[model samples]
Target chain A: MNHLLEVNNLEINFKTYGGEVKAVRDVSFHVDKGEVVAIVGESGSGKSVTVQSIMGLIPTPPGVIKGGSIKFQGKELLRASKREMRKVKGSKIGMIFQDPMTSLNPTMIVGKQIAEGLITHQKLSKQEAKKKAIEMIKQVGIPNPEERYNQFPHEFSGGMRQRVMIAIALACNPELLIADEPTTALDVTIQAQVLELMKKLQKDTQTAIILITHDLGVVAETAQRVMVMYGGIMVESATVFDLFENPKHPYTWGLLNSIPNLEGTEKKQLIPIEGSPPDLFSPPKGCPFAPRCKYAMDICLEEMPGDYQIDESHSARCWLNDSRAPKVEMPFTLEKEKTVTVGGESID
Target chain B: MTKNLVEVQSLKKYFKIKSDVTVKSVDDISFYIRKGETFGLVGESGSGKSTLGKTLVGIQAASDGDIIYNGQNIKQLNKEMKRNVNKEMQIIFQDPHASLNPRMRVGDIIAEGIDAYKLFSGKDRTNRIYELLERVGLSPQHAKRYPHEFSGGQRQRIGIARALAVEPKFIVADEPISALDVSIQAQVINLLEDLKVSEDLTYLFIAHDLGMVKHISDRIGVMYLGKMMELSNSDDMFTNPLHPYTQALLSAIPKTNPRDAKRERIVLAGDPPSPTNPPSGCRFRTRCPHAMEVCALQEPQWKEVEKEHWTACHLY
Candidate 1:
């Protein structure tokens, strides 16, 4: 089945003073129609690069897409010309950045900013675009849409600015919305509201969303499927339930264990993944997570592991998944009531 | 009972932007940090959590009320006595990037406080800086490098090292981990926890992230628009929150488990009001789900609603 968006063998690099930084390497993923797919990773993990390349937003002088095929609705995006990319960018693909403070135009009135995309892509008249922009503002749950239409970005608060961002992204009713850490800047209550708004809008518009965030809780709440990235590589891809209940990669395990459980009664010591991320300037030949992995074998440091299919809906890149390797118990489990089993032996 | 390391009574910090317009950042707030215990302060931006933290550490002078440290009022302290008290209290800022001096070496940044108090000189100061660097998980070799050379996590470690340089009895960690990545945040949190025990330190842990604050703090206080809404034991506050604001704040946190994702969330409406002209009665009433007639008419008194649990709410 054809997906709304598909990325295959995506390799991105940056020219630096010291050496060429391998920002992203051999990453592959897909987003089905109206589905929410999340890319979870820390800083320098290339999650942003993967999505930025989708919208043709990466600058070329320092950033170079060495190899990849980004297909949107079966059309090749990576090789598209500037004019061709422009047509697809706002109309077919919309993006929300991390900071609403800088992303939105400060001088321009926000309503016109929302209307600019509609006027360009849909070729609507000025009056009609104005009417639609106000409607879009209202649709995003912003109060006093008509009054707010004339106001600048500075007039709105952080949460309201994000809401305006949502209004702009969904203005032309794009098929896919890419939100890069959309609520990372907002407070928790405001984040909850914004996430709720996005979910509601997604349900109404049937827009496929690619959410890029490091917060697992946000991923759990919104994403249907999760792609855990490390050292610019896709380490694990699984359904949200499977990712939380039975995460396969050690990197994923470390992420899950590090966050304190809000609902938990007992105060458990956080098991932080020791050491920092791999230096991308000269990335390791083997698994990017091998040095941090406690169960790292000799072969893990020698060669990069291929994708090991755990089930129909889950896959992980790790040497431990090999049949020859010894079975190891998972250090953490989300299922508090039941025993978790790995390779058939139950762990109590 | 454990002695209160620091006691704050009705402390107020107001910033005047205009001649007439006054922003009450920390308004009539009172709390105490027990000896060697972490007191977590949770609130959103513009809620005055940072202002209260700054006031406690003497970075900003309180507009009103008294701050008693070790049973002596800090306001009454002489210049010499104040200097001695200032050395005991230090702060770790939120942004690791902005906190450290860009031109200074990591070693000199850590030694600034040591030199200010004249606690050590020459070889002793160098050794102290090295010891602090290693204690926070960075190697002693890192002292020679500049702040620009380190990552966000490592820069935070340098900040921690600098704070520890003074050998402060009480430290105000103002959203130290908020600037870091999730995995890196845990590493720094563990470092702080370890140092708290070994160095015999008390912390005024201020952050918007409720989950991490709950993990580290013995007691937790919920602040809204420069007022303390609730205060209680960490576990009790989570399980049985009294203030409507606290309940909503707790519920607003996204659940990690997919099964628990659909749980009801009391998402507050609109952004928190500006501190310059805050709501007349209860500061949280404008956005609160359970706002009563009295909520807008009168400010609720801060009283102990339950045993060892304090709340300022009309519901109580």
Candidate 2:
């Protein structure tokens, strides 16, 4: 597989008043060319930290990438010079954030924001950049791009503002687009529009995407492959089908079961993960999810489980996947033969 | 069948921006919540679901409508009667962090309703607060800490405790769990379910997530541009949607299972029209996939299309 981006032993921590808060620990994943890889995790799971490190957006004073190797297209990002990093920031790799309201500049016009990246990275003239910015805005499904170009960020609604953010990110035509919860702030209908727009744009541009989100529904919709993160560690990485169908990790099972599905009848009970996400400040030893894992074993608590390869492209960091460990059924059986009462004698 | 706890009739809440221009946030919508049942009001942002919730709780004044709580119209209640009605209705806001006071301790925040009604005092008050905290899955120790100390989910629990303090019969939870993490959302949802059953409470659950609403709600009302597009039992609405807007909204929800590729998504063309200048006829006509000339020319009548299923669409 032609890898567009790769990270090895990515360790990131924050220097707090009391102690060093380990945000991302020994995380490694690779995004293939023209592939959409989703990094799914709850808040404080280090999903955002790993992506921020990719864009060099992590503030060094508080956020220090203690140890890691980030290679974008075989070029080392951490070791890249200031001048080189600038060239790579917007032109090679672009990023869109969760809140478009704050991510966008209040003082500047929306069009000018997109133009700035084009002018800086593509070395386009001001007028040319503005023209291209309008095109980029229209490409992201924003209507009346020419008229919208003159408006400030406040003039646009939440979903339109997100379109502007996408316009800016894709303006320079970067090879990789890192969208950190792009549709999280938008409403469901608008979220659907944005996700569809992203899928269409990805197909048209063939831009590899790194989607960081906590919603499993979104993972199933957009991602081809998924990396499940927990307590600053990658618990599982597999194709979306394999991850959803034959999930190996207990945490993944919990996440999959936690979400209420639209296809089936509303289950009487949603099997929520018993405990909250592990605290990063004093993260537990061994498996970070051992406390919440239903099939947790003695080895799971005593020592960290290494990544056990399930197939050529699938792997999970769980003791349950070990050959020596006794076979354990996944905590939640997703497709139970649900008997539909309303539909009469039908099985799902 | 349960009796109606609260009934809203032609509730209209419009905000005047200038001399003549007004934003019709909630324009003449009617719905009723059964006792001990969850009535879900779902719509995107600016669809007036929150405004309707506020109107139901008596927080926002209605332009013209009747909110019948128990037996009396809350809008027409006397000062004493209004105070008594206020004791029975409560609301949980969307942003838990902003809804809570930073300076006040969790105990004082939860006890605000208790203190207002003069329910308890001193040792009894403290015990009540402690019980409320523990009921919401928080410890008694949590009462001493400020709102900033608790996590987003925990803060929401405190909000629930505060709402439960007054023993409110009808609670309007406006996107209460939307701000929490996915895992924490289930915990808060489960807590709310447990409390509802134990306290014999009725809920007007307002949210934008259809899937989550379907799980908790017995009946659902789909709103579009301040108008009720579809209202039906949760299962019937999801299984056999009548309104085009409801169908689009249901299809918009992202499916979780990748293998079940049978579901087709309906991506709406554009964002909803501004409430200030809503469409002439059907509010959803501009975005409706099956829009016709009549749809743009005349407003659709809200009619019962099937047994216990009501919809506002020209297609029906």
Candidate 3:
């Protein structure tokens, strides 16, 4: 079966006064028709840059896609013409941004904003688009759609505006939806509502979602597969269960140990990953995380490790995964006996 | 029994936007912080948790009621006594980017309190700044650099160092780690925990992140629309939440392990009512799943429902 989207050896750089900053280096991944994939990383890890390139949203003067291949449904997106890419953007692929306040047009009616996409892509009449826009509003769980149709973005609350964003993204029924830190700005209760809505919409529409977030809990709650990115590189990719049960990369281990577990009774001292993220302007030739990795060997500092397959569905980029390397025990584990049911029910 | 370091009585902070319209950001909330304990405040955006913290620290003057520090009401103190009390309480704001002055060197910024209090001068002042830098996990070389030169986590350390410069007994850390990256957030949290012990400090830690708050705080308070909904020990708050709103809030947190059974979330209906015109009687009645008729007719009395656990709800 062909992947709905395939990204291979993507290398992106930005031109600054200092030098060319290698924003993304040799990152590769794929998404099935209805799969949910999460890319987890800290700031400057190139998670946003990788997704922005897929949408052809990167500014050319500052951002340069040095080398890569982005194939959506077997068609090469990198070499596509401007007109062709434009046709594929909103009609075939949709995106929801981080900040709802700044992303929406303050002057225009939100209902019109949702209708505009339908008119442009589906070529519906004005009246037909307006009717469908109200329906779309209702579909996203916003009440009193008829009255809300005439309101501007400023009139809507943050959560309601985000509902508007979701309505706009799913208005065209795009096969792929990209959400970049969609709930990071909202409170936990509000975040829960938005995540639930996104999950329901994905199920009903059968849309493949590429969720970009720095939150590990959000990843566990919503995604099936997880990709851990560090210093512009894809460090690890595994099923969410495998990733959480037995994370392979040192960076992944660091991330797991850093956060305080909500279910755990004892207050453990957080073992933070010492030192800061690597400078992208002059990315290290070897492992970018080597300087911070506690288990770093001489080989890790001198050479970049290749992807080592742990199983058919799991892979990690670390020298320690090599057969020749010494076996080391992970400092943390989520024991089966310790796992407590959240709210005590299956999500499905 | 440990003494209460700070006690608040019927504290209220209201903002008047129109002739008749008033935004009661912190309305009739009473609580106390025990000596050397970290009190966590959790709430949604318009919940006014920040306002309550500000009022306790005297950053925002309370419209009514009293704030008692070590049994002496702050409002009753004279100018000199008030100034001394002010020095013992300081605040670390949420945004690291906006809090520090960009033009000032980090050393001078940290020495702002040191100079104001006349605690040290010349080399002793410089050494004090250096000692603070190392204490928060920064090097002495960082003193000469400006705030713009450091990362979010490093800048927060500078903020912490400045808070400790005056040798304050209490600090209001308002969402200090919210702006940082995940790994960076951990580093800052660990730093705060270390400082609380070495400095013998009491913290009013205000944040929306429940997990971090639960990890750092000895006691926890839940706020909604300028009202204190519940207050209890951190462990009891999580394990046996009594308030309907508290239960919903705890259920809303995403699970850390994917394999764990999905939480049967008690999803509240609609956004929180606007603070400008909150619902009559109980502020949370409009969205409460268990709202009763009395909840809308009369406001619930803030009472101790169980030993050491307090909540304001008619259900009790």
Candidate 4:
């Protein structure tokens, strides 16, 4: 796999009334060509901020990327000029936001809006852009594409509006797609359809996708690799199989345990992480998650743990991963075992 | 004789658009909730789940049918009886940011119901407010702070505290945790469960997420555009769904386990038909992969396929 995009030592801060909010702190990751990597995190985990920085779309004054190197196709993005960034924004790297209603122009016709990208990026004529716009709409699985093309954003439903947004993003055939919680607003069925559409599009176009979402289910289904973020940093990174089967970080375990299973099994108690996310204004001196982490040691409070390698592709940032720390079992797995043993005894 | 906490018979809520057109938000839906049980309502956007919730809480008046609350038809109740019924039924809205009053302190917002009924006076009311705040996992000092001072999850807890202040027997949690983060979502769900037991509360938990619904609900109801598609116990619904729509919905829930990555997914085609001009007969027929000719020609009857398991489909 060839590297398509690489973000190294990324740091972002938002100047708030309270203080300087360290939104994204020393985050690093990379996406390979034709590969899907999911950045999984809660609201303030900096997953969205990292992606926004990559797109050079983060607002200034209030928002600032303190230090980072974002390289796309061997070209540095942080140092890129405004004109250069604009040319690369939609044409080279397409983005789909969570709310399609806000992203789309309320007054503009859907087709004309899509055609604008093609006209600017591909240098297509008015007639060509219109024709391509209709074709793109049809490709995204919107029924009666011609009719939908002329309708306004308000005319479409939530799911249909999302498809329109997808059509616009994929119009110029960008090599990379950065989808920020694209299907969060849609229902489960519609989300399934949109995800399926994205997988199919990737197969045909060979576009590398960086899917940023808090949904582990989405990550398991669509992404090959996963990066679990906490306190504005990547706590754990691994292949989908490894992450689910042999998760290392305590935060990852908490996330997996918090979600209710949908396999028609008896409901198990969800082990929610205690306390809320750390305040970004003055982040913890050591580990950001130490306050909520059950396995916190004395060192965990005073010093941060670096990424300890588990294998060639899997790594986690936790004191438990350190050789000096005592071995500890994952909480959910232990709870499951206890239940299983009790059930076995009851059967006897 | 079995007593139902709340019962609905052929409920309909229609919104008029201009002079001719009308949006059939909730059209001819009937169901009942047993005491101390969470009834889950799941659907896509514009499926009328919120409309059903609003109508039940009397925020939106039903255009037709009856709402029997504690053995009295709510629509037919006198002004005095209606005021009394309001004390038993309350709602926790989806957006806590918008639901809570910006001008009032947390204490006043939670005491609004108490004050309306003159349930308590000056010092006693303050004591009750502080107790309610602590019950929902908030600090007693939080009562003095405004809504803006609280986080999204904290604000939702305040919403719960306000609902509990009146000692409501039934609460409508209309996507209460959807706006929260995933980790915070679990906390809210657990808090709701804890309160349900301590307060002896019955909830109409309306949300689109199937996993979260199954966790908190004893029974689940799936709705399509302005119509109920399926209803059954939560376990039975997931294990053996009869309706095609229900099965598709269950299948669409992305499995968290990576080993289940190869799980067969049923991706429904096209968006749900508009409620204003829903398809003739079954509303789900337009998007149903198993759609037959009769599905378009005639509406399916709501049938009890098995004991306490109901579905609306021609195949069943």
The chain B TM-scores of all candidates, as shown, are 0.98, 0.98, 0.99, 0.98
Off by over 4 Å in 3: A336-348
Could you arrange the candidates by DockQ from highest to lowest?
1, 3, 4, 2
Which tens-of-lDDT digit does each residue in B1-316 have in candidate 3? 9999999999999999999999999999999999999999999998999988888888889999999997889999998999889899999989999999999999999999999989999999999999999999999999999999999899999999999999999999999999998888888998899899999999999999999999999999999999999999999999999999999999988888897637578877789989999999999999999988999999999999999999999989
Off by over 4 Å in 1: A336-348
Over 4 Å off in model 4, which ranges?
A334-348
| Docking quality class, candidate 3 | medium
What tens-digit string does per-residue lDDT give for candidate 2 at A19-82?
9999999998899889999999988999998999998888989988899899999999998888
**lDDT tens digits, residue span A1-348, model 3:** 799999999999999999999999999999999999999999999999999999999899899999989999999999999999988898899999999999999999999999999999999999999999999999999999999999999999888899999999999999999999999888788888899999999999999999999998999999999999999999999999999988999899889878887874677677788889999998877899998888888998889999999998899999999999989777667863453332211112
Kindly report which residue pairs in candidate 4 clash with one another. none
Per-residue lDDT of model 4, residues A1-348, tens digit only:
447998899999999889999999888889989999999999889999999999998999899889979999989999999999988999999999999999999999999999999999899999999999999999999989988889999999888899999899999999899999999988888899999999999999999999989889999999999999999989999999989888999899889878887764667767677789998888888899999887788998898889899999899989899889988776544234443311111111
Screening candidate 2 with a backbone cut-off below 3 angstroms (N, C-alpha, C), the clashing residue pairs are none
Q: After superposition, how far is residue A182 of candidate 1 from its true place, in Å?
A: 0.6
Better of 1 and 2 by DockQ: 1
Cα lDDT of model 1 by residue, B1-316, tens digit: 8999999999999999999999998889888889989999999988999999999989888999999999999999999999989999999999999999999999999999998888899899889998999998899999999999999999999998889888899999999999899999998998899999999999999999999999999999999989999999999999999988898888888889998888878878888888889998999999988998999999999999888899999997
Q: Which one wins by TM-score: 1 or 2?
A: 1
lDDT of predicted model 2: 0.88
